[model samples]
Target: MRTINRTDFLSGLVVAALGAAGLVEALRMPRFEARGADPFTVPGLTPGLLSAVLCVLGIVLLLRGMSGRNLTEGAQPSITQWTRASAIRTLFTIVMVLVYGTLLFGRMPFFYATALFVFVFTVGAELIDTERRLPAWKLLIGGCLLAGGAAYAIDFVFTDLFLVRLPG
Candidate 1:
Protein backbone atom coordinates (compact mmCIF):
# COMPACT_ATOMS: atom_id res chain seq x y z
CA MET A 1 0.00 0.00 0.00
CA ARG A 2 1.23 3.47 -0.86
CA THR A 3 1.29 6.09 1.88
CA ILE A 4 -0.68 9.28 1.34
CA ASN A 5 1.36 12.47 1.36
CA ARG A 6 0.58 14.89 4.17
CA THR A 7 0.80 17.80 1.74
CA ASP A 8 -1.97 16.43 -0.44
CA PHE A 9 -4.25 15.81 2.55
CA LEU A 10 -3.83 19.29 3.98
CA SER A 11 -4.28 20.92 0.59
CA GLY A 12 -7.56 19.07 0.10
CA LEU A 13 -8.85 20.10 3.49
CA VAL A 14 -7.97 23.75 2.79
CA VAL A 15 -9.82 23.70 -0.52
CA ALA A 16 -12.88 22.13 1.08
CA ALA A 17 -12.95 24.79 3.73
CA LEU A 18 -12.68 27.57 1.15
CA GLY A 19 -15.48 26.06 -0.90
CA ALA A 20 -17.75 25.88 2.13
CA ALA A 21 -17.02 29.51 2.91
CA GLY A 22 -17.85 30.55 -0.63
CA LEU A 23 -21.06 28.53 -0.60
CA VAL A 24 -22.16 30.25 2.56
CA GLU A 25 -21.50 33.69 1.13
CA ALA A 26 -23.30 32.87 -2.08
CA LEU A 27 -26.34 31.60 -0.22
CA ARG A 28 -26.57 34.77 1.83
CA MET A 29 -27.35 36.93 -1.18
CA PRO A 30 -30.86 38.39 -1.09
CA ARG A 31 -33.23 37.17 -3.77
CA PHE A 32 -34.60 39.82 -6.12
CA GLU A 33 -38.05 40.03 -7.70
CA ALA A 34 -37.41 43.02 -9.93
CA ARG A 35 -38.93 42.75 -13.37
CA GLY A 36 -36.44 41.48 -16.00
CA ALA A 37 -33.79 41.10 -13.33
CA ASP A 38 -32.55 37.86 -11.87
CA PRO A 39 -31.73 39.04 -8.36
CA PHE A 40 -30.99 35.59 -7.02
CA THR A 41 -28.45 35.02 -9.71
CA VAL A 42 -24.81 34.58 -8.78
CA PRO A 43 -22.32 35.45 -11.47
CA GLY A 44 -19.74 32.87 -10.47
CA LEU A 45 -22.20 30.10 -9.75
CA THR A 46 -20.81 27.73 -12.35
CA PRO A 47 -17.24 28.16 -11.18
CA GLY A 48 -18.40 27.94 -7.58
CA LEU A 49 -20.09 24.64 -8.36
CA LEU A 50 -16.97 23.45 -10.06
CA SER A 51 -14.94 24.49 -7.04
CA ALA A 52 -17.29 22.52 -4.80
CA VAL A 53 -16.95 19.47 -6.99
CA LEU A 54 -13.20 19.88 -6.89
CA CYS A 55 -13.31 20.15 -3.13
CA VAL A 56 -15.16 16.86 -2.95
CA LEU A 57 -12.70 15.25 -5.30
CA GLY A 58 -9.87 16.64 -3.28
CA ILE A 59 -11.32 15.15 -0.13
CA VAL A 60 -11.60 11.84 -1.86
CA LEU A 61 -8.04 12.12 -3.02
CA LEU A 62 -6.91 12.91 0.49
CA LEU A 63 -8.78 9.91 1.86
CA ARG A 64 -7.42 7.68 -0.82
CA GLY A 65 -3.96 9.00 -0.20
CA MET A 66 -4.40 8.23 3.49
CA SER A 67 -5.68 4.76 2.70
CA GLY A 68 -2.55 3.92 0.77
CA ARG A 69 -4.17 4.31 -2.63
CA ASN A 70 -1.65 5.98 -4.91
CA LEU A 71 -3.69 7.81 -7.50
CA THR A 72 -0.69 9.65 -8.88
CA GLU A 73 1.69 6.74 -8.69
CA GLY A 74 2.75 6.91 -12.32
CA ALA A 75 2.36 10.64 -12.89
CA GLN A 76 5.45 12.73 -13.54
CA PRO A 77 6.59 15.23 -10.95
CA SER A 78 6.56 18.01 -13.58
CA ILE A 79 2.92 17.34 -14.34
CA THR A 80 2.06 17.55 -10.67
CA GLN A 81 3.96 20.81 -10.34
CA TRP A 82 2.11 22.27 -13.31
CA THR A 83 -1.21 21.21 -11.81
CA ARG A 84 -0.31 23.07 -8.64
CA ALA A 85 0.52 26.17 -10.65
CA SER A 86 -2.82 25.98 -12.44
CA ALA A 87 -4.65 25.78 -9.11
CA ILE A 88 -2.77 28.79 -7.79
CA ARG A 89 -3.63 30.74 -10.93
CA THR A 90 -7.30 29.90 -10.51
CA LEU A 91 -7.24 31.14 -6.95
CA PHE A 92 -5.52 34.36 -7.99
CA THR A 93 -8.12 34.91 -10.70
CA ILE A 94 -10.85 34.62 -8.08
CA VAL A 95 -9.09 37.19 -5.94
CA MET A 96 -8.87 39.51 -8.93
CA VAL A 97 -12.61 39.22 -9.53
CA LEU A 98 -13.31 40.05 -5.90
CA VAL A 99 -11.13 43.13 -6.19
CA TYR A 100 -12.99 44.11 -9.31
CA GLY A 101 -16.32 43.78 -7.51
CA THR A 102 -15.13 45.99 -4.70
CA LEU A 103 -13.88 48.60 -7.12
CA LEU A 104 -17.12 48.51 -9.08
CA PHE A 105 -19.05 49.44 -5.95
CA GLY A 106 -16.78 52.48 -5.52
CA ARG A 107 -18.07 54.12 -8.72
CA MET A 108 -15.19 53.03 -10.93
CA PRO A 109 -16.14 52.27 -14.51
CA PHE A 110 -16.31 48.51 -14.85
CA PHE A 111 -14.64 48.31 -18.26
CA TYR A 112 -11.71 50.50 -17.38
CA ALA A 113 -11.11 48.76 -14.10
CA THR A 114 -11.43 45.32 -15.60
CA ALA A 115 -9.09 46.19 -18.43
CA LEU A 116 -6.51 47.51 -16.03
CA PHE A 117 -6.77 44.34 -13.99
CA VAL A 118 -6.24 42.18 -17.04
CA PHE A 119 -3.20 44.10 -18.11
CA VAL A 120 -1.66 44.05 -14.67
CA PHE A 121 -2.40 40.42 -13.97
CA THR A 122 -1.22 39.12 -17.32
CA VAL A 123 2.02 40.99 -17.15
CA GLY A 124 2.57 39.99 -13.55
CA ALA A 125 1.94 36.36 -14.30
CA GLU A 126 4.38 36.35 -17.18
CA LEU A 127 7.06 38.09 -15.15
CA ILE A 128 6.79 35.61 -12.34
CA ASP A 129 6.85 32.43 -14.39
CA THR A 130 10.20 30.63 -14.51
CA GLU A 131 9.62 28.99 -17.86
CA ARG A 132 8.67 30.21 -21.34
CA ARG A 133 8.75 33.90 -20.60
CA LEU A 134 6.42 35.66 -23.00
CA PRO A 135 7.73 38.69 -24.90
CA ALA A 136 6.79 41.97 -23.26
CA TRP A 137 5.31 43.36 -26.46
CA LYS A 138 3.11 40.31 -26.97
CA LEU A 139 1.83 40.41 -23.45
CA LEU A 140 1.16 44.14 -23.51
CA ILE A 141 -0.64 44.26 -26.84
CA GLY A 142 -2.59 41.04 -26.42
CA GLY A 143 -3.73 41.81 -22.90
CA CYS A 144 -4.83 45.34 -23.81
CA LEU A 145 -6.72 44.37 -26.94
CA LEU A 146 -8.48 41.40 -25.36
CA ALA A 147 -9.39 43.25 -22.19
CA GLY A 148 -10.56 46.34 -24.07
CA GLY A 149 -12.74 44.37 -26.44
CA ALA A 150 -14.32 42.34 -23.68
CA ALA A 151 -14.99 45.41 -21.56
CA TYR A 152 -16.59 47.25 -24.46
CA ALA A 153 -18.79 44.33 -25.35
CA ILE A 154 -19.98 43.83 -21.80
CA ASP A 155 -20.69 47.52 -21.34
CA PHE A 156 -22.63 47.72 -24.59
CA VAL A 157 -24.75 44.67 -23.82
CA PHE A 158 -25.63 45.80 -20.31
CA THR A 159 -26.40 49.40 -21.23
CA ASP A 160 -28.16 48.93 -24.58
CA LEU A 161 -29.92 45.59 -24.30
CA PHE A 162 -30.41 45.03 -20.59
CA LEU A 163 -31.04 48.69 -19.79
CA VAL A 164 -28.95 48.21 -16.70
CA ARG A 165 -26.56 50.74 -15.19
CA LEU A 166 -22.94 49.76 -14.85
CA PRO A 167 -20.36 51.34 -12.60
CA GLY A 168 -18.98 54.48 -14.21
Candidate 2:
Protein backbone atom coordinates (compact mmCIF):
# COMPACT_ATOMS: atom_id res chain seq x y z
CA MET A 1 0.00 0.00 0.00
CA ARG A 2 1.11 3.59 -0.66
CA THR A 3 2.44 5.70 2.17
CA ILE A 4 1.24 9.16 3.14
CA ASN A 5 2.58 12.07 1.14
CA ARG A 6 5.36 14.08 2.76
CA THR A 7 3.81 17.47 1.95
CA ASP A 8 0.45 16.48 3.37
CA PHE A 9 2.05 15.07 6.51
CA LEU A 10 4.24 18.14 7.03
CA SER A 11 1.40 20.54 6.37
CA GLY A 12 -0.81 18.70 8.84
CA LEU A 13 1.89 18.65 11.49
CA VAL A 14 2.61 22.39 11.18
CA VAL A 15 -1.04 23.35 11.31
CA ALA A 16 -1.76 21.03 14.21
CA ALA A 17 1.22 22.31 16.17
CA LEU A 18 0.23 25.95 15.68
CA GLY A 19 -3.36 25.21 16.62
CA ALA A 20 -2.34 23.34 19.76
CA ALA A 21 -0.03 26.12 20.82
CA GLY A 22 -2.65 28.75 20.17
CA LEU A 23 -5.23 26.76 22.12
CA VAL A 24 -2.90 26.58 25.11
CA GLU A 25 -2.16 30.30 25.02
CA ALA A 26 -5.82 31.14 24.62
CA LEU A 27 -6.73 28.97 27.60
CA ARG A 28 -4.18 30.82 29.70
CA MET A 29 -5.82 34.19 29.11
CA PRO A 30 -7.54 35.57 32.21
CA ARG A 31 -11.31 35.81 32.27
CA PHE A 32 -12.78 39.29 32.53
CA GLU A 33 -15.59 40.36 34.88
CA ALA A 34 -18.74 38.83 33.43
CA ARG A 35 -21.18 40.29 35.97
CA GLY A 36 -22.14 43.24 33.80
CA ALA A 37 -20.27 42.18 30.62
CA ASP A 38 -21.80 40.41 27.68
CA PRO A 39 -20.90 36.73 27.52
CA PHE A 40 -19.15 37.32 24.21
CA THR A 41 -17.18 40.23 25.67
CA VAL A 42 -14.72 37.98 27.51
CA PRO A 43 -11.12 38.50 26.45
CA GLY A 44 -10.51 34.86 25.56
CA LEU A 45 -13.80 34.28 23.82
CA THR A 46 -12.63 34.92 20.25
CA PRO A 47 -9.19 33.42 20.68
CA GLY A 48 -10.58 30.27 22.26
CA LEU A 49 -13.17 29.83 19.57
CA LEU A 50 -10.63 30.43 16.80
CA SER A 51 -8.12 28.07 18.39
CA ALA A 52 -10.73 25.33 18.68
CA VAL A 53 -11.68 25.74 15.05
CA LEU A 54 -8.03 25.59 14.04
CA CYS A 55 -7.51 22.44 16.07
CA VAL A 56 -10.49 20.75 14.45
CA LEU A 57 -9.38 21.79 10.97
CA GLY A 58 -5.84 20.65 11.68
CA ILE A 59 -7.03 17.24 12.87
CA VAL A 60 -9.09 16.90 9.72
CA LEU A 61 -6.03 17.73 7.64
CA LEU A 62 -3.99 15.14 9.52
CA LEU A 63 -6.62 12.46 8.89
CA ARG A 64 -6.78 13.36 5.22
CA GLY A 65 -2.99 13.11 5.04
CA MET A 66 -3.09 9.62 6.58
CA SER A 67 -5.65 8.39 4.07
CA GLY A 68 -4.25 6.49 1.10
CA ARG A 69 -6.20 8.22 -1.63
CA ASN A 70 -5.29 11.38 -3.62
CA LEU A 71 -2.30 12.09 -1.41
CA THR A 72 0.43 10.64 -3.54
CA GLU A 73 1.00 9.80 -7.16
CA GLY A 74 0.71 6.04 -6.50
CA ALA A 75 1.95 3.25 -4.24
CA GLN A 76 5.12 2.66 -6.25
CA PRO A 77 5.94 5.89 -8.05
CA SER A 78 8.05 8.64 -6.53
CA ILE A 79 6.84 12.22 -6.89
CA THR A 80 8.55 15.57 -6.57
CA GLN A 81 7.09 17.68 -3.78
CA TRP A 82 8.72 21.11 -4.07
CA THR A 83 9.59 22.94 -7.24
CA ARG A 84 11.31 26.24 -8.04
CA ALA A 85 7.98 27.90 -8.60
CA SER A 86 6.70 26.80 -5.22
CA ALA A 87 9.87 27.98 -3.55
CA ILE A 88 9.49 31.36 -5.19
CA ARG A 89 5.91 31.56 -4.02
CA THR A 90 6.92 30.73 -0.44
CA LEU A 91 9.64 33.38 -0.50
CA PHE A 92 7.20 35.90 -1.88
CA THR A 93 4.80 35.12 0.97
CA ILE A 94 7.52 35.65 3.55
CA VAL A 95 8.46 38.97 2.02
CA MET A 96 4.87 40.07 1.88
CA VAL A 97 4.36 39.29 5.57
CA LEU A 98 7.57 41.02 6.52
CA VAL A 99 6.52 44.12 4.66
CA TYR A 100 3.11 44.07 6.28
CA GLY A 101 4.55 43.78 9.78
CA THR A 102 7.46 46.18 9.42
CA LEU A 103 6.12 48.79 7.04
CA LEU A 104 2.34 48.85 7.16
CA PHE A 105 1.93 47.96 10.83
CA GLY A 106 1.94 51.00 13.17
CA ARG A 107 2.73 53.19 10.18
CA MET A 108 -0.75 53.39 8.71
CA PRO A 109 -4.26 53.26 10.11
CA PHE A 110 -5.21 49.71 11.07
CA PHE A 111 -7.97 49.31 8.54
CA TYR A 112 -5.93 50.65 5.66
CA ALA A 113 -3.03 48.34 6.46
CA THR A 114 -5.40 45.41 6.82
CA ALA A 115 -7.05 46.34 3.55
CA LEU A 116 -3.77 46.33 1.66
CA PHE A 117 -2.60 43.12 3.28
CA VAL A 118 -5.83 41.28 2.60
CA PHE A 119 -6.10 42.51 -0.95
CA VAL A 120 -2.52 41.62 -1.87
CA PHE A 121 -2.55 38.27 -0.10
CA THR A 122 -5.90 37.17 -1.51
CA VAL A 123 -5.10 38.26 -5.04
CA GLY A 124 -1.70 36.62 -5.00
CA ALA A 125 -3.03 33.40 -3.56
CA GLU A 126 -5.86 33.22 -6.05
CA LEU A 127 -3.52 33.86 -8.94
CA ILE A 128 -1.06 31.27 -7.76
CA ASP A 129 -3.68 28.61 -7.02
CA THR A 130 -5.57 28.86 -10.30
CA GLU A 131 -4.15 27.46 -13.51
CA ARG A 132 -6.62 29.30 -15.71
CA ARG A 133 -5.77 32.98 -15.63
CA LEU A 134 -8.37 35.46 -14.51
CA PRO A 135 -8.57 38.98 -15.82
CA ALA A 136 -6.53 41.48 -13.83
CA TRP A 137 -9.44 43.89 -13.47
CA LYS A 138 -11.69 41.21 -12.02
CA LEU A 139 -8.99 40.06 -9.61
CA LEU A 140 -8.35 43.65 -8.50
CA ILE A 141 -12.03 44.31 -7.84
CA GLY A 142 -12.54 41.01 -6.07
CA GLY A 143 -9.51 41.59 -3.86
CA CYS A 144 -10.78 45.05 -2.84
CA LEU A 145 -14.22 43.72 -2.01
CA LEU A 146 -12.80 40.82 -0.01
CA ALA A 147 -10.43 43.11 1.86
CA GLY A 148 -13.18 45.63 2.69
CA GLY A 149 -15.56 42.91 3.84
CA ALA A 150 -12.94 41.28 6.02
CA ALA A 151 -11.91 44.58 7.59
CA TYR A 152 -15.52 45.47 8.34
CA ALA A 153 -16.28 42.08 9.83
CA ILE A 154 -13.15 42.03 11.98
CA ASP A 155 -13.73 45.60 13.20
CA PHE A 156 -17.31 44.85 14.09
CA VAL A 157 -16.42 41.63 15.87
CA PHE A 158 -13.62 43.09 17.94
CA THR A 159 -14.74 46.67 18.51
CA ASP A 160 -18.51 46.39 18.65
CA LEU A 161 -19.43 42.84 19.64
CA PHE A 162 -16.43 41.97 21.83
CA LEU A 163 -15.83 45.54 23.04
CA VAL A 164 -12.10 45.19 22.46
CA ARG A 165 -9.96 48.04 21.21
CA LEU A 166 -7.50 47.38 18.35
CA PRO A 167 -4.06 48.89 18.02
CA GLY A 168 -3.00 50.84 14.98
Cα lDDT, all candidates: 0.69, 0.79
Weakest 10 consecutive residues, lDDT, candidate 2? 71-80
CA lDDT for candidate 1: 0.69
Candidate 2 clash pair list: none
Q: Write the per-residue lDDT of candidate 1 for residues 26-128, one digit (tens) a residue.
A: 5555445454556436455665676677768777766755775444656523334556668777777788778766764346777788677777777767665
Q: Best candidate per lDDT, number?
A: 2
Model 2, residue 50: displacement in angstroms? 32
Give per-residue CA lDDT, model 2, range 61-92, as digits (tens). Answer: 77777874473335433345567767768877
- Model 2, global lDDT: 0.79
TM-score versus the correct structure, for each prediction: 0.46, 0.48
Best by TM-score: 2
RMSD of each: 10.4, 11.4
